[model samples]
Target: MSSGPRDDDVLRWYVGVPIGTNPLILMDFATVLVLVWAFAITAVVLLQLFFGHSLTGEHIQAAARLATRLVLLAAAGFAIISFLLLRNRYTALYRLDREGLYCENMRMGWGEGGLGELSKSFHWRPFAVPPLRDPAKSVTKKVPWRLVDKVLPLEGTRTLLFKSGRGTAARVYCPDDGTFERALRFARAHIPEDARSGPEKELQQS
Candidate 1:
């Protein structure tokens, strides 16, 4: 791991998952399913409202069937997206600085050089179904330290999860024990004392 640009002494590292087996990938797939189901249900309700149809057991069953179909479609879409990402050996660079944590999926393999630049120039129109963008071109999430309500360390996966009241704000995937230790130490220093949890808090108490 190395510090980022001259502007800030940022701790940064790259995490590459060639197979898309990371738990975060599954979490994203689940999120897609949830959103698809939500949309399907909302559409059904809106259609019923437009026709002045009251809610009934039959309508509920029909909604369930529709949701199942939508979930299947979402799963297919997820598979295609995962394939595209894994085919390129998905790589993400994580940077932790004074302000917050920044995670950017970098363009790898085929999507590099001039082609990647060309893709970056293209913009999606509002309300239009956008094509599957390069994994590197995906939106990045920046989680501020102030919103970190809990720091959860998973020894099995060598991952440190920064969580807020809402949910996981950021996930730092350490490549090794040394990296994990360094990240945990940095988290302990920045995160509030009251938010500390697990064995770290116990050790601190002692």
Candidate 2:
């Protein structure tokens, strides 16, 4: 095989998928905390409106202190949310040429060509999506996502990674333009008929 893709290779289609732990899990917990905070603040405000007249100055001061705490708590919730979602970035790369395809599961931390140990590789004829953990059997040259971030949206891209190969291969979902489907078909047709198949079951997202 050639050392690298050529300039006029006519990159028919390419895409990468990024993977990350679900933010929904963190979101659910954050919701609970927010609900508790809202309920507590509401209760305090109600009590103050009804009981402020009879309450001593000290009691009103205590209520004010409680409100302060709620503000701080709200700020903390925002921070937690940013931490959970912002920090999480799932990334993958899938690029195809007339000859073969190049896909990488970057969310596992393959940024740039730094996939050194984390990258997976596949070629056209006798096409294959080899696993990274099983390195001895596979000899793939890492393929970087030269334009994954530029062309595709992140969420859609992230969902793309976990299709079939966990990190190496992916299921071609309802593509709006069939880029993924074409890539999958191209891989199957061009890659070895018996190229190592991916795991039996994989993460499925509609």
Candidate 3:
């Protein structure tokens, strides 16, 4: 029902997440690439077995060669696509207040030189790469304190995961240790006592 938080009502900051910097982001891309490669190889093998007379050593060898080629080609394409989509470091605007948390991914522009520049060239205009989201628009999510059922901290990534009954409500990425501590303290004070996870003493020690 609420439109969004007013600027004066919250603490706001911008965080830049560059490609290959966050393991969580990298893992997501890797998972997708693996799935694509597996599906392609599976489909090919299924088709070969369906139409072939019998499973022979030669058929297996041929399938192996095809699979290898497919994996290499898929990997290359995945890397290219990932670079094109993420070349511009992702910028997220985070706003926190007594009420809840708000996160918005600002529009991004391609950087100069390399693939970014190549994609913008007139010669490649027809096949130009597009951003994952509309480059001119931002995407936002708002999570209220009342709706938050759990607060999970990931020390490795310096990220906080807020979860509701449905699933993950929102994710907050901290830029540094100090910021992470501040955010965690805020979360502890606002979220329900029962919803807190992990050792409180360990957090205090850190």
**Residue-pair clashes per candidate:** 0, 12, 0
lDDT-best of 1 and 2: 1
Question: Tens digit of lDDT per residue, candidate 3, span 65-107?
Answer: 7766776786676556545565534556677898899888764
Which scores greater on lDDT, model 2 or model 3? 3
Candidate 1 or 2, higher TM-score? 1
Give the clashing pairs for model 1.
Answer: none
| Candidate 1 C-alpha lDDT tens digits along 41-76 | 878977876796687777767887999898998777
lDDT of 3 at 140: 89
TM-score of each model, in listed order:
0.65, 0.26, 0.65
